[model samples]
Each structure stands twice: as structure tokens, then as C-alpha cells.
Target: MRVRMTGLAGVIAIAALLVGAAPASAAPGDASAYGARLDVTLLGNPAVHAEPFAAANANGPTQNTFVGVDLPGILKTGVINASASRDDKSGGVYSRASTADVRVDLLSKVTGKISAELVEAECAATQKGLVGKSKLAGVNLGKLGQVNADPAPNTVLNVELAGIKIAEVIFNEQYKNNDGSLTVNAIHVKLLQGKLGSLGTGDVILSSATCGPAGLPIPMASGAGLWIGLGLLGVVAAPVAFVALRRRAALNAA
Candidate 1:
């Protein structure tokens, strides 16, 4: 009985190893499957896409014990886990639904200009691939009005840095959520290239990717390769089976 039980346990272990050997559909507690994905390509004299993400979520540091919550401090709030990404082949922009409640507070005091200049400076120095004249511009998404916290104050703001233009981009959304997590979705950002005079006039690309969940690190493709290898084994085995079957038939005919 003991020996039989040991053999059964060995079989189960082997099966578990096989299933776990590749990136299977994420199990429960694992992030839900990556939802929909979007991609875009454009052409013209000014070739580029400024696609915006639909809806999404992001994070940050401990709220100040007493300062009135404002945009600059909120900007400092870091996203612990972001479902943000960008890719030429896979997607242009993406957003996760805000999980917490939201009530955006529009503040007239905050000017997007400071953030715009700051971003442009950073890009000119580090983003070699992004060459251009760019600056921030606001799209009149009129009547966004004052944002407020829902249920009274927790909401999530998901922002992906990947999809932003290198030269300059402006954020005008003023927000607050019931749970303290506020989310901002697709916003119009201007693009530019070459010289300062030429900024916000032509070609640029924008994009984002859905990050899985908070706390978990972004998943690498190593597991994807493992699954691909398993699939290739299936293809190779099919040919070997065909050859073996042909041999058996030939002998029987003989």
C-alpha cells in the first residue's frame, strides 16, 4: 500500500511540474488575463499617432498628514504597480477601469506649463530616438467641471509614462476620488520636433500597455518562451508519428 501511494504521489508531482512548466492562463489570485489590446499606425506628410488610453489606474506615496492635496504633490505620488505600457507592434494606448470612487477637483491655480517645460527638458537630454519640437496643448474637453471624491474619496489614477510624447505633453485633469485614488484617462497631448519654433507641429507617436496588478512586478517573456517550446514539441512530434505510421503500414502491406 505504501509503495502504491508513493507511485501515485510521484505521478501527481510530474503532472504539476508539466502544468507549471509553462505560462498557463493565469490562475485565480494571479492577475486576470490581459484584457483587450489596441494598436495603431498612421501615414501622411506628418507620420505619427497620438492615440490616447481610454481609462486606467496608477499609485503613489503616503499622503501628507496636513497639506491641502494638490496636483504637484499628487504628481509625486508614485505608481507602485502600473498596467501602463507602449509598443509599436502590440498597442498604442491602454487604460484600466478605476477601481475606487472618484470626484475630480479642478483647480484653476495649477498650470500645465510647468509640467510641460519640465518634461521637455528631460526628453531633450535622455530620449535620443525622440527628436522633435514639442510642447503641451490642452484639448477643450469642456465641462469636466470640478472633480470630487466619490462615496467621498478613494479612486485610482493610472498613468503610463511610456505612451507620453518625448518633447512635451500637458495634463489638465484635476481629480479626487472617494477612496483617495483618482484616475485620469485619455488626454490630448501636443507633439513637436527639430527646433523650439517647430514644436507641436508634426510627427509623434503615443502608446500604453495594460499593467497586470498592483504589487506584482511586470511579468517577463521567459515563461512565454517556455510555452512556445512546448508548442513546437507538439509540431515536431506530429511528423515523427506520421513517419512511424507510414512504416507500420508499409510492413503490413509487405
Candidate 2:
């Protein structure tokens, strides 16, 4: 009986060591975001092409801000802000972007003006938290049509010049990247026509965000807990075995 109890204790101790040596859980996903990205041309001349402020894979909170920019009669902006952050607690990521005071004069025919406010975009691990918000104050799109404040993903607003389609305004643009990441753009302007009567063609983006895939769930008893429990069992068995051996020795002596 004592030998059997000793063997059981050994087995329990070995199992505890194995459980403690198991590999750890996978790490959380990465995150990336930008305030504004512009790739445009005026009569084949590069106007504004750059991503002014951006962040990626930061362990903590990160942010950036820009005063204003201009393309002289083509496009103009005021006060751009962007931010990105990660939550180690929930293994989730988040990002946001916003712009203010925007004006776009395309060939002086199809003009757009937004007063003191522009757009914002947010991204997170969950679908409910991923959204695009438009704060287009005093918006006036001359001959282009109305702007949707809360536009769905890939919502397109056609641009026409003299009853002919010339360009398009895409809102809440979202893409599921090949690597399972999600990208959200608050606003995207694409000039389809090569030249809208000498204006030229290009693309413009505002308030962009992206986040990597969700992390796998972690299980309980996958770490030290399992080892500790088995260790306690081994301790109890050792004392029980010692007691059994002492009693057997006394009986043999008698």
C-alpha cells in the first residue's frame, strides 16, 4: 500500500511539471492608422501626395496633429488630427482620425465646402465599434449632390459635369485585407475622368484606420494553476504514504 501511494505521488508530480512547461498563449494582433492620405494631380501636376501623420503597432497610446494644408484653388484643409491605441487587457486594438475645415474647387464647376468640420473614422476588433462618422458642418456640394453624414461602407456619391459622370465620392470605405486585417476610410474622392476640362484626375483620402485580426482566446488551467493543484495532490500523497509505511513497520515488529 505504501509503495503504491509513493508511485501515485511520483506520477502526480511528473504531470504537474508537464503542465507547467506547456507553451504560452499566442500574442495579440497589430494595429495601424493615419489621419489623412492624399494622392492628387492638377493638370498632370502632382498637387498633394502624402500621409502626413500615421501610427502602427504601438504598445500604448499615440497621436498626431497638423495645422492646415492647401493646393491653391484645388483643395484646402484646416486642423487634422489622428490617433491609435491598443488594449492589452482585452487583446483588442483601436484607432481614430478627424479633419476640419475642408474645401475642394474642381475646375470651379463642381465645388465643395465644409465649414469648420470634416470627417472621422474609428476601428476596433469588434464590428459594432468599427464605424465612420461625418461631421461635415455647413456642407455645400455645388452640383455634386448631398453628403451623407452617416454613410455605410463603400457608399458612393456620383459626380457629374454637364450631365456626364466625371468623378465619385466614396464614404466609409472599408476593406478586409488579405491577412485578415480591417481598413476603414472615412472619405475617399476619386476623379474618374482623365481631365475634367483641364482640371486633371486624382484620388484623395481622409481619416483612415486599420487593425489586425482578433487574438485567440486563452483557457483556464493552461498555466500555473494546473501545476499548483497537482503539486498539492503530491504533497498530500507523500504524507499519507509515510503514515502507511510507519504503521506497516509497527505491525511487523509486533
Specify the highest-TM-score model's number: 2
lDDT of 1 by residue, 1-254 (tens): 44345445555654565566433422111111011112222213333332222222222110111111122211211111124223312212222221111111121122221221111100111111211121122222222222221112222222122453323322322233343222332222333333333323432111112222222122222455556655655665555556556666776798
Query: What TM-score, over all chains together, does every model reach?
Result: 0.22, 0.67
Regions of model 2 farther than 4 Å from truth = 1-25, 54-61, 106-108, 112-116, 127-137, 193-198, 217-254
Model-by-model lDDT, in order? 0.26, 0.65
Residue lDDT tens for model 2, 14-56: 5665455433433555666666667777665756676555443
Off by over 4 Å in 1: 20-210, 213-254
